[model samples]
Target: MADDAARYLLGIDVGNTVIKAVLFDLEGRQVGSHAIDGQSTRPEPGHVERDLEELWRNASEAFRRCVADAGIEPGQIVAAGCAGHGNGLYLLDGDDRPLVGIQSLDTRAAALAEELAAEHGAALHAATLQEPWPSQTPVLLSWMRRHRPEVLEQAGTLVMCKDYITFKLTGRKVSDISDMSGAGLLRMPECGYDDELLALYGLQGLGHLLPDLIDPTDVAGTVTAEAAAATGLAEGMPVVGGLFDVIASALGSGVVEAGATSIIAGTWSVNQYVSSEPVIDRDLLMVSAFGPDRFMIMDNSATSASHLEWYVREFVERGGHHDDPFGFCHRRLAEVEPRLDDPYFHPFLYGSRLGAEHRAGFNGVAGWHGEGHLIRAVFEGVVFEHRRHVERLRAAGAVIDHATLSGGGARSEVWAQMLADCLGVPISVADGEETGALGAALSAGVGVGVFAGYEEAVSGMTRIRREFEPDPDMWAHYDHRYSTSRDLAEALQGFWSSQYRDARRENNGEEEAK
Candidate 1:
């Protein structure tokens, strides 16, 4: 037998809703995978946070289950990688112990986002190439400074979710470049934290919170004996710096070339294209894509499956015989489409590109419609939001001839076909659902010299399953609906603003009475 490649890789991805540990062979095929379903604690509306220790416990437990289920020994894993959701803030005390972890799905910093924009939006865009959002690390830190200065006074460092886990595993407090880039803290041209950008964001006073950045492919550290015992992994195994889930999904889906784009619809609508040069033309997020020359040009937000998940969980009672809730909702949704006068839903429950005043709602609902119509509206609404980003990318001269679809929203044939038709592009579904984990493993392969470099690793590991061609007839129909959706958003701009203003006034009155 020719030298049989027997080594395996372990990829750990800590997302907003789940902690996934997947094992992949050198060929990039998944040998086995396991997931732990956990949720962030919502103390109040829009304030999404997690208990730091609980998050780590879920990740470590998932590792044990993954190893046991995969029937792979800890020593068999040659190298490992850790992938996490980008942005948000995970702080460590002076003792390097985790404080509280705020996930990227949070909107607690909305007021701060407005404050930053009104004061320093242009400067921030010039530096980071994206506008401020509520979940970014800097905005979160600013909110803490204003509301709870005591925590900031006692804090030692701030890191992303995976950075904290990496620190726990290797006793090093380092973060991957992609995570830092998206945190609205780094200067794109310099690829490091900038004093000017910090000053503009009014965050220079707290620049000590930023963690050191390392390349995604760099070996962050060796798995220490303490971490190894906790997670059933071999001690001293190499742990590489992995990309953010957005970059990881692109890497995992094989969108490594400039023209190749990827749509990730997990908790967020990440519409990104791989580019050789970092362009700062308009308001788009750019992050390092594992290489110095390469960056992921992303128009993204918590505006994809998160919207659908929220709608079904709150309004629909879908359960019992179905495999999952979305499945049931989609099954009913597939029955209603291509018809005009359908309700238009704004996927702004989390936040909106239409400005801070925008909120989520369904328009054109009537007495004749049932639960099925609302379900279908939710699907189209989220897809419409994704199309909005795709349009922005297209306008920027980004070639999105064809794109790979990966995540929970892509699995639905109805929604997938709708996405293809609506975007007017051939959408291909990638082979693996755990693209983020696979991305991590491939980077580990690069770190350990299993592959010569990132390019070789990506080629050896990525595969496409099926492609859905856009239907000209369906595209014509969706074109009208898309225009209507845009018009609806524009029309409601005044109403959304007035609603927000009135609500704030009511709350102020209540506070005065107290």
Candidate 2:
């Protein structure tokens, strides 16, 4: 390769709300960045989708803008990689035409998930190391088989968001191990498809729909001429297979070592820990394949900053005097006293696994309390939710010494300090703003032999921006508050379970009627 070609690597991150692309030099310093805003299509109450053509177009535009900003010729780029949201299903016909984009958040497959769990009990769990969930591939596929059989019957290939984009660029129908593991098909220890799961789900012949699994740093293929023309990149540029967004974020935040934990506070907050082996707790959840070895244990809270954003928009609409609502809220929170009398709020705007039936509200509010009290209550409630996840991880035998926090939410000093106090662990912010893109670039560097290993690459690139240490007095107060929150969450678990069952039954009855 020419010297100019060896100087730059392109990284693309496909998120639910937007697609981000970054241009990095050989030294891993970000040279240029671009983003394209996109929204998920919600045709019905529970369905979500994106136009595959538009997704590709937006990604291509992002690449063009970033490359232009860098002032580099397209042919100067060396290797490229892509990362994306996991567990979303995208179907393609034999000619690579998109059938549909299955939204990951849609819970139409809940009944199918339960059915798979019932039919394949311990064996299935041992194989996949994951209980059947509505978001899993098997359950989603089962839902399609029953609801939209025509789409499944005609689908010649099944892939996730990143796989589809990679195939569009490289003309290879393949998936990386990280993406495959999230699909509820790959056997955990074996690191391949679980035939028992396939048979149990009546998908024995659906193997063709899956992709060839490759290592996270493997060279999947080179970009084709067609892709090159469309994206304004040189032909034959190497494309590395990158991991899912969670793993990429972990890598970018420098949490590669065992026992190192991170909280990626995006629209949803995912707490992750790298483990030498899979740590299973019936209560805590997992999104594995994040570590280099067997498993990277993870659990997620559906609402985090998104909930905060909602509250800010609803409550602080007219009070826009100084800065952004979030900034204003932070300023207000710092002035208020830490302890409140009787205004405890549950930050469950979209409902939570803890209590789906309960509507979010403040337990006590009076004329004395104003917007500041309400905002602080919401912020504290979110931090308490993080505490719940931390307790769950500890119970599952993962010793989390400290946590590296990243994402848009981590930028707030007040939120970071609140998290530290609530979890009683030191919290630090990641070095860069685009950690996900940086992580994908690091994976590509490893694939192309730019670095010796994952460790060396991260050590040379990742940095910490700010650190928050827990306050003893605040920690003591949060400890009691967290205990109360857990008790409340547990008290509603049975009610939520029943509500879930009833909703599933109602949906199934509607389907049967049709």
Candidate 3:
């Protein structure tokens, strides 16, 4: 008889700061997991990057630790899959050496994004179902081509975060339709490479940089001897094409069917739903879904729990609260007394959907407030931003009666409840914390025929751990707060524009004058 370990699969989730390797049984039960934090460096203002070598090291260590924790032979693992944050540029030089590793939090291309949107907004939207955004892969590539032409001169294949991990594991330069389409590198609806899109980005003749496009479940390659030695995995283990992290999270949250929404409150605010047809009435972020002939209508931005993370790292950790800083935040939030006069915050530390010039701040702060009020405002601000994305989806005809919540925010009962109350809909949290990893593992299972397809895999593996219903009492309060926040954001747009322009002029004097 086959041993229990024989049915195990491995999944890797690569986020901006954390790399997780998790093992799951055929039934989707998480058998073992390990997470390692990676450092992001800000070499210049608005530039967020990582070391590719460091990322691979962290991933390999995570895999080794996870397999050991699971107490299973690496040979028993059937296949592996990776899911990573989407829309950042990962490049290998002409000689196949790590070049630049820009993360999705980058805003260096904000000015360029604005320029492109103004000049070719309609064309871009028509082709890719997306508008030029600061951290978009194509936009960033264009920036590199213009400002740092030497980088592209030596560039080799372009890949996403998960694809980088996949390449490292299997020695294959490949990406899936979900990530390439999500990165605005492909024409929408049909989901294929379009030279026109690259030309529009001024990246003409660089088509060779794009990796081979494959289905998410396609077996891209297998673990080589080098990778197996580094990661402690079996030498012939299969590696699937992998997935965009948000799509993986959706699958992990049991949102394979149309009309089901998945809200990932991670470093980015990702609100999306699967649709049989793509929505083109309005300019919205969308990508080809994992399932055939489906589209994931999205309204995502860099505004999300990242703001809270910054606050915690800067203020809370600096004050000597080391153990469970988030727990400390939850306790403080519990102390806050909801009042109409409470201060509100703008969760735009990264970029905002409203405009590229938008920045984050706390509004209406008074001497009378305390830490709890600030923390509560931070929580509310994050949820309010997610609400903005969900509203955009709703405007694009997404029927969101309910949603599955995942990511770091879902772990916090306070934030999850706030989200449910603010959105005025039922929010369900999945059983596992590492939903992205679980989603990648599902693809692995599908690749190896352990499950026929995503629907069957989701049905067999995922379960809602808890559900939050909208509290009718809090509805009016959140509505009022959201309105006030929206108006405040609109009121400050001029100020943001002027301030950002001035800052830019100071940083790049001759360029701004030109």
| Cα lDDT, model 2, residue 308 | 76
lDDT assessment of candidate 3: 0.89
**Model 1 lDDT per residue over 1-514, tens place:** 1332568888888888788999998888788788988867887566788888887788889888888988877888989898899988888988888776888877767777888888888888888877777788888888787666788788999888888778877878888878888777778756788788888766667777777789988989998999988988889998888878888888888878776899998788889888887767655644454567878888887778878778767766445444577767867776765478878788887767656567889999988777788887878888888999888888888877888998877777777888999999899988888999999888888988888987898899999988999998888778898899999999998898898777556645753574
Model 3: worst 10 consecutive residues (lDDT sum): 282-291
How does each model score on lDDT? Answer: 0.82, 0.77, 0.89
TM-score of 3: 0.97
Report clash pairs, candidate 2: none
Rank ordering of all candidates by lDDT, starting from the highest: 3, 1, 2
Candidate 1 deviant stretches above 4 angstroms: 1-4, 286-289, 317-323, 502-514
What is the total number of backbone clashes in candidate 1? 0
Tell me the alpha-carbon RMSD of every candidate: 2.1, 3.0, 1.6
Candidate 3 residue spans exceeding 4 A from truth: 1-5, 510-514
Best by lDDT: 3
